[model samples]
Target chain A: MTQEAYRNRVKAAAPKSPLGKNIVMAFLFGGGICTVGQAFLNWYLSMGLPQKSASSYTSMTMVFLGALLTALHVYDRLAKHGGAGTLVPITGFANAVASPAMEFRAEGVVLGMSAKMFIIAGPVIVCGTLASIFCGLCYFVVR
Target chain B: MQTLFIKTPVTVEAHAAVVGKKEGEGPLRDCFDLVAEDIFFGENTFEKAESKFVSQAINLTLKKAGLKPDAIDLLFGGDLLNQCIGTSYGIRSFEIPFLGLYGACSTMAESLALASVTLSCGQISRAIAVTSSHYYSAERQYRFPIEYGGQRPPTAQWTVSGSGAVLLKNGGRGVRVTSVTIGKMLDFGITDANNMGPAMAPAFVDTLKTHLKDTHRKVSDYDLILSGDLGSFGMEMARELAKDEGIFLGENYADCGCLMFDLKRQDVHAGGSGCGCSATVFCGAILPELESGKYRRVLLISTGALMSPTAIQQGESICGIAHAVCFEGE
Candidate 1:
């Protein structure tokens, strides 16, 4: 009858163990995710990048660079794996910005296309913008 | 045919909760002004668990709406069931001309929009859009039972174990369905239905933008832009995200999902989900606020994810869709 009804029946018949499988699949993807994260660690090891410099570099570049790849629609493939894999920080923020930019494209320019696109990403940019400014002041003070 | 200069008049009436065959009705009973014995099981039908609760709720709502069998133009509803069997049974019992709608939490908004347009077009006169939910029965049947001790993430919300029904009329100077902002189910290709805030945010942004465009009203115009079930974390995320667009929904943008249970007492770290979340809030919270002149115009945005575990297993991305209904109180 209704799609909901059909889904309910299918869900009722769904194997319970599948949740166990999902749990395992979720973790397996996470493990793969960690190995990639380690590669960033390895970048420092291989390049002789400094400790504090490498850590900041890795995290910042990871988020900012991931934002770049995400806009190009490259990292979306890995996100399909679900959970911790997609949620591991850097890529998540990238997703935050790229999604709205893509959506607002259809509304043309006035408000929908220009203004609405930043709803989610807007906060990130605001915080990020302010944070950088604050950090600049601190850097000047310390220097 | 009746013509009003405002938004649609949709009232959630006749709310009743089953107190677990327990000692008392708890805060919910007091809030809805429902009597205890009003709950009764439908005989020879689906077991007394899910089916009975829904039927009892429907009858209560019907009574509150002052509706008789022949009076209800069309019965539009669905629940967590196969073929919306619970809704089917409710429809069968009342025998009102029926149309089943499934938008998960957004079902109430979806049905109201349809019912309102029908009334506005003279396709139907008096109509009812109803949705019922039961946490205990639904958890047992679909997801894990609470007793199962499943480790829920911060993203998850408690499914509201309640029922909500609204009666819409041809003439209510209070409100009319003026303009609707339709939303697309943005998956962002996410599959984790358990943590739905992010999945739902895209749809929320889309719908809110569309509503402003169609109605030509700024966010500040409406007193509230309430969502169905985005929990505490979801609310924060929505708030933080909305600010990025130079839009701030403010505290006026609360969600029904976050208010279903006393999360602290129930160990509901987040809030609630299901159709009942939005339904009860409309009847209990928003309606009262409106009636008291506390808020003039309100927008209820109910969001739902259009995905199943099977779809997830089949590697389908979880998509979220939201529909908005604007209601103004007299």
Candidate 2:
């Protein structure tokens, strides 16, 4: 068969990811993570912290939890079932950075762990920074 | 011209299979010679662990055959690691003449075919063919880090962490290598690295058809026709492709990948893959069945996708090749 024909055949035969199930799981898990962050914020607020300080502390707490779960090898299991739910949050970013670091740790500290720590998260940081700069320039000009 | 009929007997004297924890929990658990609970196999790194598996399999095979490493005329081996380090490092202590192979997942059959041909040519009296693959090693090299929380598609296959070895001699009371058909590299423009079944099915079909045509035998002539590491989807594709070419692969046809694990309980998605998938299944299950006179004739076609990470990144379609070996029982 022609390559085009074969490609079509393969496309037809390949099994697709369960979109509905994934969406539901993502919603539940993502919402659950957000709920936890809100709870942390509330607890910190009730402890007499300001709103801005409370939010920053909550973000830091979530990142620490993400990194800890990844180290314990639980985050990947959660992500397997949670899909985008675990991936769209700050915790997910922590996992994205920490997983590669743990994986390449056997190669050593500097070249292995630290260098590869940002392999997955590097692109995100670069694009996010660039986009923010662009938006900042636009805001400055309009203001 | 692709198929060669062995005039001199090339018999399988002994064989061994070593698998990791997950595969030990599989349906063929009882068939493996050694099922290591630790995937590390007592090594520091996964790569070293894979090498340990290869060596263990060879040692076990040698012990079973009651032959010293020096008695073996040649050793043919390979693995999925870069530069075939798994085979080289694993077999280094044996001090035997070695020729390494790199047929991707098809290394088992490629080595077997080459060993058989070399033995049949009367150049070697005793030879061993072995191949292995490790799940973690393969994953880190091919896909992502083990701890990476990325969801794999349903079409993805679990690489089998295992090794299989077989000893072949000029004459013996064991399974005989009757014929071999080397396949041509064929690309169907498949680009999805996750869906390897379809990427390799065409090559399996081509090699199977060529072997059948060359031997002038029908598919039913053999007691079993097994494809190496095609998994579920690829096996189905092979059946469909073979049907299109007027060849009906009946109930006797199966895939090593599908047989290597429990599809429902194992969560292996499509099924087990890698060089070890077919290698372990063939050594652990099929060889014993053939030895016990349960099967008279069997055909093994190990298919491989020959795309590297660089090639895939460059938007090059994956090309596949398969090697077919025919084994018969006395």
Q: Mind giving the per-residue lDDT tens digits that candidate 2 earns over B77-153?
A: 99999999989999999999999999999999999999999999997799999999999999988988888787888
Query: Model 2, range A1-143, lDDT digits (tens) per residue?
Result: 99999899888877889999999999999999999999999999999999999999999999999999999999999999999999999999999999999989989999999999998899999999999999999999999
Model 1 chain B: worst 10 consecutive residues (lDDT sum): B18-27
TM-score for each predicted model, relative to the true structure: 0.63, 0.98
Tell me the TM-score of model 1. 0.63
Supply the global lDDT for candidate 1. Answer: 0.63
Worst 10 residues of 2 chain A by lDDT: A6-15
Q: DockQ: which candidate is best?
A: 2
Interface RMSD of each: 17.9, 0.8
Q: What C-alpha lDDT values do all the predictions have? A: 0.63, 0.93
Q: In order, what DockQ does each candidate have? A: 0.01, 0.82
